[model samples]
Target: MVKRNIISVLDMKDDMPQLVELAEKLKKERGNHGEPLRGKTLAMIFEKPSTRTKISFDVAMSELGGHPLYLSARDMQLDHGETVEDTARVMSRFVHGIMYRAFDYKMMDRLGDSATVPVISGLDNLEHPCQALADMLTIKEHLGSFKGKKLVYLGDGNNVCNSLLYACAIMGVDMIACCPAVRMPNAEIMLGAARIADQNGSKILASHEPLEACVDADILYTDTWVSMGDSTSEEVAVKIFKKYQINQELLDIAKPDCIVMHCLPCHRGQEITDDVIEGPHSVVFDEAENRLHAQKAILLTLLK
Candidate 1:
């Protein structure tokens, strides 16, 4: 049987066409198709604070005629030293699928390995394939296609950046990751993206300077310098990511009307400035809303 969960963008293209078609269907049938997951239960376990992932998945499951059971790490046996594999085995017997957002990618893998039913990675430390789906949908909606588009990613090379690399590579979108050396994407992930890019006529290039990446870029994107598991020290975040901020000067380097994007829950002053994020070209909120539509597509393709 085919596993239905999304763990990383790597090894993920098999269901993409189906996923995109479902996204289109969900867009048309938002007010209906409310019974797609009737009698199905989705277990949503959270290991981090979220506004979008939590709300989107809950609403998506319910709207599709499924029940979503939300649980946090602190409230589960995870706090009592329960293994994720055990949790996965148990939840599989109770729920039709499992969606978890965790601070570590390995935990999600273990859970997926043990589940009898489908397991969805709501998120993990290293990749966010769902968010990338939404971002790609938004870009396609705005640009009419993904082929040959110049997408630039500016900021710390974190999960969002890695996800974008995979998305751009898959869809033939040329991408440049502008980040400091220390914050660049993992070498293996980069190599994987590059290999895909070579086949798809896209490219994944990285540079330490922002202006170089932003040059002739059609889309400018960023994520927070520090994410959920990081130490919440303002000074440390600022110091580490000083060179990667997307400000007005960097904006000027891109096309005149280039779109700006963030994954949301942004630390405004750190990764992006107030004007750029709220500016005329910003599409961050639209990207956020697509989270609902895109993940719905993912659920249907993998679990329906």
Candidate 2:
């Protein structure tokens, strides 16, 4: 069998909806589901620090009766000049799968190309497919369906936004990435997702006006303006992103039932406000919890 690698959201392709359904099933079964990966092991390599990505993948592996081995890049020979391809070749011999959270997308792609077994992207500079999966699950759970829903993302066009574009496009959900012109998502990714969205009967749009983008939106999403390893200073980012914050005013512009979301480590006063994230319409925690179930589904699909 040919090995599968989820280096990008498009890799899931037609399997995305099925994976979301599987995630829902796993969530409900929880501890009742028997071990399917009893003797398997997943090697998790981290080149960047993470809270949700680390804990969620670790817990997901344990819940499925699989072992997760955490490896910090700094502690490995990779830090001292070992190539990612060599590390991937070595790790594939010992583990059933490899999950990498990398600072560089190029390195992640190299690892995926070299690995013999399934390789998953915990995150990379360009994409966060796992988080996007969880976001899809959460949207499905809360909104009941993706049919005619519109999601407006108000923040920097970072990795999270990039993956969401692919996820929304695949699921037939209309998405508008609203950010400053200078902060727009990768042009190539936007164009690719637009093509996919067109085929799915939905549309992907870019807007510099947040208020206009939020009008009639069914979901409102945002992330920190300044991400890890970002070269932009907080003071400057905050100044530019002030109008894009997901506060009560912004939420009011969207549909009355619009659910607010923020991929965590959020800057309360910057990308999102305290009251909005803690408000009745907020599903941030639920979205966070879905990470475990979504990733479990991904693991089963690739490794089982």
Candidate 3:
């Protein structure tokens, strides 16, 4: 049998609808859910610090009757010059699947290529496919549908935003990346998403003006301006991104029922404001919770 790896959101484009549906089903089944991955094992490798990604995958594996082994890069032989491929190959022999959160996309790719077992990207510098799945699930749960919904993503177009573009395009949700030109999402990814959006009858767009992008938007999204491993100084990031903050002014221009989302570990006053993230429009927590259910679906699909 062939193994599957989720290295990018586009990799799951064809399966996204079914994945979202399954995640929603799993979410509803929470505590009563039976063991689908009984006796299986998942190896989780982290090259970066994580909160939601770490916890969600751990809990998801546990709840599904699987063992979750956490491996930090510092504790691994790779720190002493072992290749990622060697680590992946060795781990594949002991695990049913591998989940990697890496700082380098190239290393993530190499891991996926070498692992014989299924490989799931917890996150990398290039994309966060799991997060995108959860984001899609959250949107479906709230708005009940993706058609005609407009999501304006504010601030840096980092990994989260890159994945969201493909996820939104796949789900037929129009998305606009509102950020400074210097912080725009990968052009190659944007083009790929635009192609997918064209096929789905949705559009992927970009804007430097936050207010213009937020108008009539059904969802407002943002992430920290300075990500881990980013060399940009916080002061410099703030200077460039302060205007793109998701606050009351932007919310007021959006649809009255628009929901706000942040992938978390928020710098309260930076990319987003306290009043907004804590306000009635915020579905950030719900979004965070969906991470578990979404990943369970991924696990079941790849490992079962």
lDDT for model 3, please: 0.94
Tell me the deviation in Å of residue 266 in model 2: 0.8
* TM-score of model number 3: 0.99
Model 2 C-alpha lDDT per residue in residues 143-225, reported as the tens digit of each score: 99997999999989999999999999999999999999999999999999999999999999999998799999999999989
For model 1, how does the per-residue alpha-carbon lDDT over 1-304 read when each residue is reduced to its tens digit?
Answer: 6666687876466656556667867877897875878888888989988999999999998898888899888889962578777878888889888888988888888887888887777778888988988888888777788887898887678888888898888888999988877778877888888998899888889888786778777898888887878675878778878777888888888888688889988987788989878888899999998899998887776667
Clashes by residue pair, model 1:
none
Judge candidate 1 at residue 297 and give its lDDT.
Answer: 84
Please state every model's RMSD to the true fold in angstroms: 1.6, 0.8, 0.8
Error of 1 at 71 (Å): 1.1
Model 3: weakest 10-residue lDDT segment is 78-87
Error of 2 at 80 (Å): 3.2
Q: Candidate 3's residue-wise lDDT over 180-287, tens digit each?
A: 999999999999999999999999999999978999999999999999999999999999999999999999999999999998989998888899999999999999
TM-score of each: 0.95, 0.99, 0.99
